[model samples]
Target: MQIVILKDAAEVARYGADIFTTQLQRKAGAVLGLATGSTPVALYQELIRRNQAGEVSFKNATTFNLDEYLGLSGEHPQSYRYFMDQQLFDHVDIDKNNTHVPPGDAKNPITACQEYEAKIAAAGGIDIQLLGIGRNGHIGFNEPSSGLTSRTRVKTLTKATIDDNARFFAADEYQPHLSITMGIGTILDARKVVLLATGENKADAVKAMVEGPLTAACPASALQLHRDAVIVIDLAAASKLADIEFYQHIEAENQKLQAYLASL
Candidate 1:
């Protein structure tokens, strides 16, 4: 895993967006893995701006969202499908038919989970995946203790996760305690992964993910085994990382090396 420490949230968003932009530029039809949450919204906005500016195109690309609330239909205001439509699909030239979010209203959720995995396989696997870490270090609703090699499946949300997300629902709104999410193994299958986090609230999670052991306690740590996983965070989120300065040094040296190679 490569840890990239930046100055602030806006810089983190731009850096993460540039990774996606480069992937799409290299392969317009790349299958993208997406995540939903406040942290990724800024990155999505940056992508939208690039698309509108003719810097990139999603016209031929296909997308799959990481998870969805189990009891909500796509039309539900709180569903991830609706979120993506409003935040991205609607603003880009991508074909709506090519976008896929796990079926939240499936009669047999188990079957739906299996089908979701099959669909990803049929798409030739994800070329790049975007992610946002929860305060507790959960990724894609795979809370603590999730199997390191688990696959697409229905999962029960932890109390902490539910409480953290409670703000999204109205006081009397029906909030789902269940979700369908891609497993840690599933996310690790991506050719490349970019995880973005910001704010002081995420400091501890960032520290654990970057320097913690490869244990299920922090699901995001599974990325440690991935050959190409990039963790992008602002200084606020990166505050608790013990070796922050070393991470910054590595990033600086990497930039210099890239510049040297480019000039040659």
Candidate 2:
């Protein structure tokens, strides 16, 4: 696992965007695994800027979103489908036919999950996956206790996740109790992964993910086992991490070393 501590959320977003753009450039028609949430909003915005400047083009790229709230229609404002269209797909050149979000209202969600996983496989697998950690360490609504090797399936959201996501709806009653998400094992298959977090509210989770033990309780900690995963966080979110300054200083030194090597 690699950690990058930025000065603030905006910097973190730009860094994430740079990473995304570089990866897209390396593979123009790459399959991108996406996530929707406030944390990644700025990164999407930066991508939009790059698209407009012709620094990058996503016209040929394919996208597969991380999860969706079961029972919600795609038109629902709070649904992941709506969120992605509003924040990303609509703003970029990504082909509508190439983008996919799991069906929230499928007649048989279990079969839907299997098909979703199959589609990912058919796309040649994800080249890069972007993630955001829930307050309780859930990824793609795969709450605590989710087996690391689980596949795409229906999951019951924990009370904490429901409460945390309640802000998106008009009332608590509007929040869906169930969600469909990819399993950690599926996410781990990606060629690269980038997880982003910001704000003081995320401090504890970020610390646990970066420095705590590898336990299912902190699902994000599983990234420790991934060969190519990077965690990008703002200073406030990284505050609780031990030896954070040492990590930051080392990163600075590495940058200087790279620059010196280039000059040579």
Candidate 3:
């Protein structure tokens, strides 16, 4: 696990984008696991900029979104599928057919979940997974007390999660009380993971994730057992982390080391 604290959200986005672009550059067909929510909006925008400038290309890459509202179709504006299309896919040259989002309204949701897991395996597993922790320490809708070794499947949304997502819906509109999400076990399979958080709202969650014990209570903490997990946050979001200065110092030293090695 590596903690990278940056000056602000924009810097966090640049750092996240660099990680993805580097992965795609090294492996053109790398399978990318994506997440929805505002935390990654800037990172997606940065990737689009790089694509437009010819600095990188996602034409041969495939992507899988982390979760989707249980009853919404891909065409629904609030669905993760639509979110990805408007935010990243429509602007990039990637093949639309290669991108996958769980079938939220499938006739047989159980079977759909099974197929989703199989599809990921067939794609040779994810090379890198992008994540954004919820204020309650949830990841991919695996709320508090969710199984640590759970798999892709239907999950009931806690009241806290529903409330957190309420802001995205209109006052009188319906909001989903269920979702299909990849489990902690599935996410940990990724060769690499990058989680980004920003704003003061996320400070507490960030602290718990980085400093808290590995427990199902904070699903994101499962990353502690992952071989490679990188957490990037801005000053506002990293405020509650007791060892913030230590993390910053290490990041600075790492940069200097990389530069020294490159020059040699």
RMSD of each: 0.8, 1.5, 1.0
| Ordering by lDDT | 1, 3, 2
Which digits, one per residue and each the tens of the lDDT, describe model 1 over residues 79-154? 9999999999999889999999999999999999999999999999999999999998999989989999999999
lDDT of every predicted structure (CA atoms): 0.94, 0.91, 0.94
Model 3 lDDT tens row, 1-264 = 899999999999999999999999999999999999989999999999999999999999999889999999888888889999999999999999999999887889999999999999999999999999999899999998999999999999999889888888999888999999999999999999999999999998888889999988899989899999999999999999998889989989989998999999
Candidate closer to the true structure by TM-score (higher is better), 2 or 3: 3
Candidate 3 weakest ten by summed lDDT: 160-169
Which residues of candidate 1, in runs, are more than 4 Å off? none
Candidate 2 lDDT score at position 104: 95
Q: Which residue pairs does candidate 1 place in steric collision? A: none
Tell me model 2's lDDT, rounded to 2 decimals: 0.91
Each prediction's TM-score versus the true structure: 0.98, 0.96, 0.97
For candidate 2, the per-residue lDDT at 57 reads: 94
lDDT of 2 at 161: 90
Instruction: Identify the candidate with maximal TM-score.
Output: 1
- Candidate 2, residues 1-264: lDDT per residue as tens digits? 878999999999999999999988988998999999899999999999999899999988999999999999899999999999999999999898999999998999999999999999999999999999998888888898888888889999999998888888885457789999999888888889999999999999888888889888988888888999989999999999889989898778878997999899
After TM-score superposition, the amount by which residue 86's alpha carbon in candidate 2 deviates from its true location, in angstroms, is 0.5
Q: Pick by lDDT: which candidate is best? A: 1
